[model samples]
Target: MIELSREKLLLLYRQMLSIRLFEDRVYQLFLLGMVPSTLHQYQGQEAVAVGVCAVLNRDDFITSTHRPHGHAIAKGVPMKRIAAELFGKVTGCCRAKGGSMHIGDYSVGMLPAIAIVGSGIPIANGVALAFKLRKTKQVVVSFFGDGATNNGSFHEALNMGAIYNLPVIYVCENNFYGASTHISKVMKLENIADRASAYGIPGVVVDGMDVLEVYRVASEAVNRAREGEGPTLIECKTYRYSGHSRSDPANYRPKEEVEFWKSRDPIFQFKKKLLELDVLSEKEDNRIRSEVEKEIEEAINFAIESPLPSPEIALEDVYA
Candidate 1:
């Protein structure tokens, strides 16, 4: 087991809670028609984002997928900015241009999320190559789903990363479904990590529901990349509490399966462990919860009160 300081543990818990609350609030707002554009939430997979990002420096970069709120939050993007972007405000990180799927801040080292599956893999490699040529220790992480692994880009990118020994980490968040299709039906291999062998790089699989386990594995991979040991593919076996998008009811999943995964909720499990270790008291946990809730509420209010982007500037940032 990795021994984390109380402060680090608390930070982890707070980040995870923020993601849960943020996603929940976004869903509510979407239902009320307060939020524009569709949402791909990141509720059950908070641990995967927080754990991996916790080990990265501010200079290290991360490429996100459509479900990028958790990644942006974990990488230190201000909640208010993200909320404003979802509201399509001028104060948004992308100035209302990217919307939900493209939310990101280059200042924080997160690329505007790519809604295209498997596309971020090569982009991450390109960034890693620059880092290598510049002799910088900066690393890049590519976040993608199980479906992306089957894409030709995934294979081509991994092959290049392996041969060049670039400082990148390919993270596959396998939630057992590729936009509602079960993995069993599509994948012949039992584990996605096994695909790493074809590219000759280290591949690790971890329990994504356990934040500490993920942190431990991610820490090792990050350290390896920083030292120029080449790319590592870390497959996080996680789940999404919501459907593929705002419109998906996720009725295809069995009730028992959903309940089972919910029972092993990352935030709940981590809180329990913290309590057992005396790292957090019941009173402290309650205080943290209240504080996070208040923060999120304030962020929502900020987004609501912010002004929308003017139509005149719509063509300013466009590249034809």
Candidate 2:
């Protein structure tokens, strides 16, 4: 449905593979007490971020939610810096300040990812407002989860972004469950994207498992914003493979539901589609997985050996 080059698709595979390994490692390390902070793993939600980010220019920006590793890699943040940030090292992208939840670099066009739910939406407006006021063609994409839709900041931001006709893309990765609550129980509307119509804006429901499907839909939204067409609200139908956080035992979800989602794993599904299209071979996919594993291992070693930020910096990065 979209014109994705073989090289770019390969790159997407690399990005997803990279994210999977990193998050998997983080999960393991968390269990081992290697990480000081908890994590909201972005395992199953990779396709949405990568697919959406592929349509964005480097000059454009993105705001990330608690689950930001996928978005960071998709946007070209190097593994070394990301791992270093996770280690709270001076070499980190944030200079060891914004650890896990705050790993972002404005220089890279990513506002330090806001961990608070729906908190980044209004900030996204300010970023887009700056672009619009300066008459720049840049667009800003704000990535959040379904829970964010229920936050008051969500409504306030949508209204503000719409009123000013800001160049923004409000992307909600509706993975069925919000922190543990099912969307059907929390949201009255059948489709979250459908709510965009209320603000007189385009709302799109996308297949988040298919990278190309997400890319095609997001491309239109991104292009529309860049062309001064204002913001769009996109709801991606996806599922998380793990619990809300590291301590979660995942007892809230059913075994069948988890198995069903696993059966449709984004990586396997996309690999199948790529192979069917003669875009990728199983051999290449396996090799890519090997490479990704190696990269993550090296990143972990780098983080382990890197020195932690000075204790004094704890107070420095808090406000300044």
Candidate 3:
């Protein structure tokens, strides 16, 4: 595990808490009919996004999958802007167009998240290609789920990235279920990282629940990429605390399995680690939580107060 300084550890904790709180709030809002779009909450997979982005510079790019709120937050997108975007307000990053699935800000080097599974894989490769052609040292990280691994685009992108030695990191947040289907029913491989060998690149698996372990592995992979090495496939073994999407109770998942993963909640685990290491005290932690809660409330208020997008510009931002 990488030894993190107190400041860095606290930042990671804050980011994880922000994501957790943001998702919880969004879920509550959706239940109250405040948000009209579908939501794929990133409750259990916070460590993967936080750990990976922690090693990245501001200029580094990341392409996100449908479950992208955590990626945007971890990549430094402002909470108010993200909240506004989800509310479909004029002040939103995408002017309320991208909704819950496609939240991101290019100003922070994060692309508008791709909702389709496996689509961002090749898009990340393309971004890396642009960086390489410009002779820039920036790298790209592509976030996707295990279901994406089975797509043709995933293989195609990996092959191209390997051949050209693109500076990109492909992260598969293997939460064990693709939508409602278990991974076992789709692929026979015990671990998704094993597929990286087919593309002739290094494949690594880490404890997705452990932020330090994720940071350690990602730091090495990121350094390698910045040095002009090829991409790396990192399979983070994680589990989602919620169901596949809104209104689904995740009844397919066994009760024992759900409880098991909940016991390993990344936020809970990291808080315990910090306390044990003397890096944080209960009083300080409580203060942090209070501050974060207040921040989230401000974001919600901002989103609520913001005006809805005008119909005149509805078709204005389209690329085509």
Candidate 4:
């Protein structure tokens, strides 16, 4: 077990809570038609993002999938800019162009998220290649869902990453369902990590709902990559509490499964652990919760007050 100081543990807790609350608020905003497009909220899968990112350096790169808000937040992109992007305001990370799916800030080492399934895999591989060629110690992480494992890009990227010993981490957030289809209907392998052997890379499975466990696994993978030992494939067994997208009701999943996952909600479990460790008191917990609530409220207000990109500017940033 990686022993973290109380402050570091609290930081992780805050991040997980922020993601949960942010998604919750975004859901409300989507319902009120405040968000310009359909959203793929990361409600229950907070631990995977928080854990992986918490171990990364500020210079490390991360490629995110369509469901990117939690990744963006955990990777240290300013929450206000993310909220602004969601609201289609000019002050967003992508200047209101990318919106929910593509929210990212390269200045913070985050790539503008790739909304296409499995596209980020090669992109992350390419980035890791660049880092290797440049002799930079920087590492890249590719975050994708279980559905992406089936994509050709996934296989090709992992193969190249392994052959070249690229400083990249392939993080598969296996949330049980690929959109609406269950993993059993698609994959024959009992574990996604089992596929790493074919590529000559180390593969490990971690509990996605437990932030500490995910962090422990990610720390080892990141260290290995930085040491030029090669890439590692980490499969996080998680679940998405909400629908695949705004249009999805997620009724395809059984109620019992959903409830079972909910009972293991990352924030609640981590918070309880913190209290047991005597690192967080009930009063401190309440204060932290209130502070996060205030931050989200302020972020929403900032987004609402920011101006939208002018109609004339739509043609301004177009590629030649």
Residue 258's lDDT within candidate 1 is 91
Model 1: per-residue lDDT, tens digit, 195-314? 999999999998999899889988888888889999999999999999999889999999999999999999999999999999999999999999999999999999999998889988
- What tens-digit string does per-residue lDDT give for candidate 2 at 1-320? 67778999888878877888899997888788887777878898888988999888888999998888888888877788888888778888888888888878776678789999999999999999999999989999999999999999999999889988999999999998888788889889989998898788899998888888888999999989988889999999998887998778789898998888888888888888889999898898889889899998888888889898788877775554
- Per-residue lDDT for 54-146 in model 4, tens only? 999989999999999999999999999999999999999999889899988998889999999999999999999999999889999999999
lDDT (CA) per prediction? 0.94, 0.88, 0.94, 0.95
TM-scores, all candidates, are 0.98, 0.96, 0.98, 0.98
Q: Model 2 compared with the native: what TM-score?
A: 0.96
In candidate 2, which residue ranges exceed 4 Å CA deviation? 318-320
- Candidate 4, residue 112: CA error in Å? 0.5
For candidate 1, the per-residue lDDT at 18 reads 97
Best by lDDT: 4
Candidate 4's displacement at residue 35, Å, is 1.4
